[model samples]
Target: MRCDTLLLSAALASVATAGRSLQHVGRKADDSLAAMYNNVARNYASFSGHHDEPLHKRSQHQFLSNKTSSFAVNGTGIPDVDFDVGESYAGNLPITSDPKDPNQLFFWFFPSTNPDASKEIVIWLNGGPGCSSLEGLSQENGPFIWQYGTFLPVKNTWSWNKLSNIVYIEQPVGTGFAVGEPTATSEEDVAQQFLGFWKNFVDTFSLYDYKVYITGESYAGMYCPYIASAMIDENDPKYFNVSGMLMYDPVIGPNDIQGPIPTVAFVDYWTGLFPFNDSFVEDIHARDAKCGYTDYMNKYLSFPPAGPQPFILPGQDSDGVTSDECANIFNDVIYAAILVNPCFDIYQVATTCPLLWDVLGFPGTISYLPEGAEIYFDRADVKKAINAPSNVTWASCSDISVFVNDTDSSLVPSIHALPHVIDTTKNVIIAHGALDMVLLANGTILTIQNMTWGGKMGFQSPPVEPLYVPFHDDPVEGSIAGSGVMGTFHTERGLTYAGVALSGHMVPQYAPGVAYRQLEFLLGRIDSLDSVVPFTTDKNFTEQASEADLGEGNAPQGYASNWTAPASDTTTVKTSPAAKGIELSLASLAGVLLAVFYLA
Candidate 1:
C-alpha cells in the first residue's frame, strides 16, 4: 500500500555534529533514539534561550514573556525571522478534560489579513498519519516559506492567512509538538480524539458559530472526510460548524486505485524523466495488457464511470496474490526507475541527479542536510518562540506510532465517509498535483468515479475550463512570471476537481500561484477557477475590488518590466492583542511587512 504518512524521521540530529540522521522512513524513529527524545521532552524547560536574537527582538520577546496567560503565544515575532511574522497563538491543549493530562495536541493559529474572511476558520492538517502540520505552516501556503534550495525564508504573498483565520494542528497524538501515548487502533478513535481537541480550540477563541473549512494534503484526504462526517453527525453548529472541505492528492480508496492501475500511463506521460529503454518500455506495456490494467482504464476511467467499481485486481488478478508475474509491475517500475536514476523521487517523479539540501533532513528519499544548516523548529529557541514542547525531541513526523496498530480498523475514505461529507457540505474540492507519482491523478479519478455523492456517481462531463491566475503589479517576480493558465478544474454537484499543472506531492510548495487561485474559488470569492478575479478583489470588496480588471492569459510584452517606485497604502493590519500586560505592536509591525508585499 502507498504509505502517505512517510515524513521527516530525522533531519537535524546529525547535521549539527557531523553525524547522520536516523533513516526511518514511513514509521516512527528507531527505538533507542525514540526513548531519548521522549525522555528529554518530559523534562525540558517551558522556554529556551536564543542568544542569537537581536537586541530589539530580544526586548520584544521579553515584553511578550512577561505578559503570559492561557493560549497566548508569539506575542511578538518568531526568533531569527527578520520580518514581522504577525501575531499568532501556539500551544498544546489536552485531549482529556483533566487539567493535568499529559496527552496534549499542539496548534498554531494565524488570523486572516483581509477583514472580510475573519470569522471564517480554516483548519489545516498534514498526513503521515504522523507528520506535523507545522511543515504545512512553514513550507506550504503559509505566511513564509523556507524552500528546499532557498538561502533564506521568503514571503509567501499567496498565504491562506489572507483569506481566513487558519489553524494548523499536529494530531492523532504522537505528532510534532504533541505529547501523549498511543491508545487507539481505528480512524474512529482518531476522529473522537481530534474532536476533543477541537472543542478546546474553538472554546478558547470563542468561535461559537464560525464557518469552518477543513483542508489538508496527502493522507489527510482520508482524514478530512472522516472528521467532516463526525462533525456533521454531532448536529451542533456551535461546536462543529463545518461548511466546506478540500484535500490535495488524497487517499480516498484502496492504494491500487492511485498506484498500479494508472502507473504505466503516468510513466508513459513522463518518459523524459524515467530514461527507460525501448525494450523495457515495450515489455512493461505488454505487462500492462496482460495485467488487464489497460482494459481497466479503457472501461472504467471514463467521463462518467462505465460501471460500479471495487478494488483493482491487477494481472488478471485475484485473492490479492495473482499468479501473473506482472502483478508487481507498479513496484517493479519504481525499482527499475530508482536503479536508473539514483536520485528518483516518487513524490515528484521529475526529480533528477544531484539532490538538493533540505533543512528538514529527509530531502527526498534519504536523510540529508548540508553542514551549517539548522533544523529551525527543533532548536530550543524556536520551540520557545512557537510555544512548542521541548521535553521531547521533535521530528517532522513522529518516530513512535500514533496508533496502537499500524493498520486502521476503518474503511478507506471514499466508500462511506467522503460521499457523506460531499452531500452535506455541498462545497468540496478534491485537488491533485499532476506530477505526483505516489498517487496518480487518473487513479484518483477512478476512485471518484466509483463513489456516489450528491445523488450522482461521477462527473457527467470532462474537466475543460482553464485555471487562470491574473496579472498583478509586482517588481521582483514581474506580472508575467506569476500570471497564466495555472491548471484546470471542473465542478459537478458541489464537488470540484482541480488538476494543478507542474505541481508535485505538495501543491503549495511547487505552485503557490495556482494554490492561491484554488483558495479564491474555495472561499467563494470568485464563481469558479475560470473567473477573472484579481489577486485581492472579492465579493467582500464590491466597489474597490470590481474596478480592478485582470488579464486572461499573458500581459503585453514588457508590461511587467516597467518598474516604478510603488506608493504605500497605510492600511492597518488587524491582529489579536497579546495576553497579560505588555502588548507588542504586532498590528503595526505586521502592517509594515504587509505593505512591502503589496498585499494591501
Candidate 2:
C-alpha cells in the first residue's frame, strides 16, 4: 500500500499566523453543502430514521450477529471455531490481566493471522468512556460473529484480530468481565489497575517485551492516548516496548481553547442538530466566559442541571416523546440493546437490571424479565465479580475509563491544571454512526477541537494542520461524499487527529468496513515503511496482490486451515412452560396499558 502522492500543499491556502492564539485549519466552505455531498447529506439527514427498525431489517436477514465474540455461556458453550485466525496461527491464548478479576481480560494473540507472520502488536479499544471492546472484535474485524437475539453466534468477515495481535480488555474495575473493585473512585486509581493487568497479561502470555500499539474510539479517544502515555511512563525502558498510540473520534480535550472557541464549537454542533434553537446557543455563549463548559454541560445535558433534552436516534423515526419520555427512550434503547442481545456483552455485568438501574438512578420499575438468561458476550469473570445484577447489563466502561486515563492524563481531574497533550507520532482516527445518538460523534469532535496541547519535545508540536478529505470521489461535484470534516492541528507535536465521515461516535457498529480500512491505513503510516507490504501475484488467480511478506523463517511451521460453517438452530422449544409464562405477562401488560389509557 505505497503511495507516492506528495502532500497536497496544505489543501487550504496557508492562513496568516498573526494575533491568533490558536491556528485553525478548516475549509471556508459555505454551510450549504454543494452537489458532491448530496448523498452524504441525505444519509446524515436521515441517519436518525435508520435505527427505529432493527439491523436485521437492513440486512434482510433474520437478525444481525457477530460470531467472533458472541455470548453463549449460559445455555451451551460456543463451538470452537477457526478462520484465518491471522495467517500463520494456531490456537488462541485467553488469560486474565487481573488475578482477582480473572475473566476481565481477554486477548487474541495474532502472530499474523494472514499468511504473513508479523510481529507488531496492535491493541483494539472500543469507546464509551464506558463501552466494550468485544464490539470491535466481533463487529468490525476478525472473523465476524454476532448472536441472534442473545442465543446463537454468527460470524463476521472483517476482524482486526486477523491483521494484528489484538487484546480486548474490559477495564476499570467496574466494566464488563471486570468486577468493579471497591478500591477505585478516581481515574488515577484505575490507571494502576490497568498497568497491573497489562504487566500480568504480558508476563503470563510471554509477551513482556512486544512492540505495542494502543488504539480505540469515543471515550477511547481519551482512553487510547492515556493508556499509551501511561504505558510509556510505566514501561519507559522496561516491561513493554511502546511504539505509539492511535485514537479515533477521540474525546481528548473539552474544546475549551483560549477564547470562546470551544464554546463556539460546541454551540455550532448543538445548533447543527437543533437549527432553530439559537436561544440556547445565545444564552450559553453569553455566560460561557463566566460559568464555563463543565458547569454548562452538566446543567443543560445531564440530570439536575436543566430539564431533560430530547434524544435523537439517527436513521430511525422519531417517536416524538416528551422530555422525560425522550430520556426514557434513550435509556430504553441502551437497556434493550444490552438485555435483548444476551449474546451481547459489555464492560462489567451487574447481577440484575435493578442493580444497573440503581447505578443509573432508576428504581423497581425496570423488568429483569430475561431473568435467568445470561449475557452471552459478557466475560465470565465480570459476571462472577459483580454478582450479576439483574436490571443492569454488562459493559467495559471501567476499562474504557482506565485506558483513557492511561493513554493520557488530560482526562484526569486535578491534572486538568496541566495543558492537554497529544502524541504527534500517533495518528488518531475516530468514526461513528451518524444515526447513533447514544454517543454522538459530534460531541467527540467538539471534544478534540477544544483540548489544549502543552507542546512537548519529540512529540509533534501543537496546531500543525487540519485536513478535510472526502471519503470517495464524486465526479459531478468534484467532491467526495461521507468523507471527513474535522481535524486538529498538532496538539502535541507528532500526533495526528482524524474524525470519520457520516459516522456516529461508535464507528465500528456504524461503519465497520470504513473503520477497519482506516485502521489498516493507519498501521501502515505508524509502522512507517517498515511494515509496508510488497505486491505479489496470486499464481492461481493470476492477480496482483498487496500482501505483507514478513519473510519465511519467522512463519509458523503449519496452521490448521479448516473452516467450519455454523450449525442451523435445531433445539426444539418446550412451549408449554414459556408460552404460559409469556401469555400471562402480555395479558397483564395489556390490561395495565388499557387501564392507564381508558381510566385516566
Candidate 3:
C-alpha cells in the first residue's frame, strides 16, 4: 500500500514535529476541550469519556427492507462516547454473485444527511495498495474525525456525507478487516473482484440508478481508474453508473516520473525546509542532470504537450529502470534531512516533535500509538457495534504485501485509462497536496502535461486562478486563515486539476475544508471551484454573490504574490503559494517510504 507498506501507496522515513499548537474555536458546549489542547505535548492529555453530542436517528420509515436490515449497524456508541454514531451500514459482503463464495470485501456506508442521498453514493478510498479506507473515514472526511493531538473525536463540519451518501471500502483481499486469501496479482485482478463486491453491496441495499462518484487518495489513483474503466466497460447503469471521479495526491502517473524525475524541482522550490547542506543539494542537482531527469522534466513539463513523452532516461529501455543513483535522489534528500531533524516528517514536512498517538496506529509514514491507546477499529466493542467481524485484526496499513513481488503491471492512468475516464465522465478531478513529500505536485503537473485528453495534450494555461472557499462556522478546524485563497485549480474540457497548497498526502486529513470544496465541485453541487458562501447549493448560490466575492476587498484572482490577506483571518484565509517558512515539500514525488526500501 504505502512504500513502507511494501512500496505501494505512500510510505516513508519517520520524522517528528514540534512548535506551534493548533487551536479550535467551538461553542460553549465544547469550551472545556478548547483549553485541554493548548499545544502538542510530549505526554498524552487526559480526555473526558463523556460526550454530549446528539445521536442521529432514523426519521420515520426504514430506509432498508427486512432482507437488508440484517446489515444495519448499531448506531455504535463507542465505549468512550455516550452518543451513538450516525445511521450507517457496515460489514463484509460476498465479492461474487454466489452467496457461498468465501471471498468477501469489507465496507462501511453512511447515507447522506440530505433527503436525496438515495440517488448518490460517493466512494472514499486510501492509497496503500492495501491501505484501509477507514482511515479516511475516522481521520479525514468522514462525519467524525479524531485528528492527531486532539483529546477527543469531534464531528467534522465539512464531512463529505453532509452532501452525498458516502461509502468507505477496505479493498483488495487481506486489507484491514477484509478476509480471504490474497490472490490477486494485478490491478485487473483487483478491479474485477471489486466489481463483484460492488454488485453485491448495491443489491443488498436494493440500490440502482444511483449516481456513483469514485473518490480516493494515494494508490487509489491506481485502483479508481481501473475500476472506473471497468465500470464504464460494464455498460450497465444499474450496477456501474459512475458519474464522476476524484483522486487526491494519487499515483496515476509512472511512479518514476511522479517521484524521482521531479525531485530536484520539489527540493529547490521548497529549499528552505530541507536541512541538507549545499554540498548535498549540489550533489542531487548534478545527479539529476547526469541521470537525464533534468532534461526529461524541462522537456515534458510544458504546455502544448511535448509530443507524447516516453521513458527518456538514459538506458531506461535497455535496463527497464533508471540508474540507481538517479532513483536514489529522492531517498537521499529525505534520509539526510531526517538525520538533522529526526522529527522531520515527509508527509507534512511542517511537523517536528513528539508524534501524537494515532487512532489508526499508522500516523504519517510510521505506525505509532501511545500506551493504552486502543485502535478504534480494532476495539472489540467497536467492532461489535459497527457490524464488523470481530475475528479479523485491523491495521491502517496492511502488514502483508497485497500483491506478488509487490508488482502491478496495469498501465499508469496517464498512459491510457486516466484520459479515457476523463473523456467519458467529463467530470474528473485530480487534486494534489503541495505539502506532500511522497508524490510531488509538480510531478503530477508533468504527467498532465504529457497526457492527451479531449483532443488536447495539456492545459494551455497555468492555474494562476485562485480557488475560493466560503467562510464557515467550523469549530474544530475553524475557517482557513487569510482571504480563503486555499488553493489553485484549473478546468480544461472534463478534467480539473487542483493544487492544494497547505495539504499533504492525505488532503482531507491535512486540509479538510479544501477537500470538502473539491467534493462540492465534483458532485456538481457548485458550478465552479470559485464560489463565495458559508455553504452554497443551487438553491442559494448567485452569480452576483460570486461577483461580489471577487471584489477588490478580496485578494486578487491570481497567485500568492498578488494576495494581500493576512495569513490567519478567521473569515477567509490564504494557503496557496505558501508564505515564508510555510513549507510545502513539493509533493511526495518519491513517496517517503521508498527510502526504506531502496536506500535504507
Q: TM-scores of all models?
A: 0.78, 0.47, 0.82
Better model by TM-score: candidate 1 vs candidate 3: 3
lDDT by residue (tens digit), candidate 1, 464-548: 4566765443221311124456666667777887777777878876777777777766777666666554555332211222213
How high a TM-score does candidate 1 get?
0.78
User: Candidate 1: which pairs clash?
Assistant: 5-128, 11-361, 28-399, 29-399, 40-391, 41-391, 41-392
Q: CA lDDT, every prediction? A: 0.65, 0.35, 0.68
Q: Which stretches of candidate 2 lie over 4 Å from their true place?
A: 1-111, 115-117, 127-130, 145-154, 235-238, 254-374, 378-492, 525-600
Window of ten residues with lowest summed lDDT in model 1: 578-587
Superposed model 3: Cα runs more than 4 Å off: 1-62, 314-317, 477-483, 537-600
lDDT of 3 by residue, 12-38 (tens): 332332223334467365666755543
lDDT for each residue of candidate 2 in 1-600, tens digit (9 for 90 to 100): 111101111211121101122233775876566544455544422222211111121122111124222221221122333222222111112223434553344343333333221445777766544455655554444443442222233344334554456666655444544544334443454555567767765554456566676776545554565566666666453455566555554444332211122233332443333233455446444444343433433323211113322232211136522233212222332233333332111111111221221111111122122334444445454343223433335532332333322232234211331122233233333343333332333343333333334332212121212223223322212111223322222222333433333444345544444454445544542221111221111111121222232221110100112211123323211111111210000011111210000000
Error of 3 at 261 (Å): 1.3
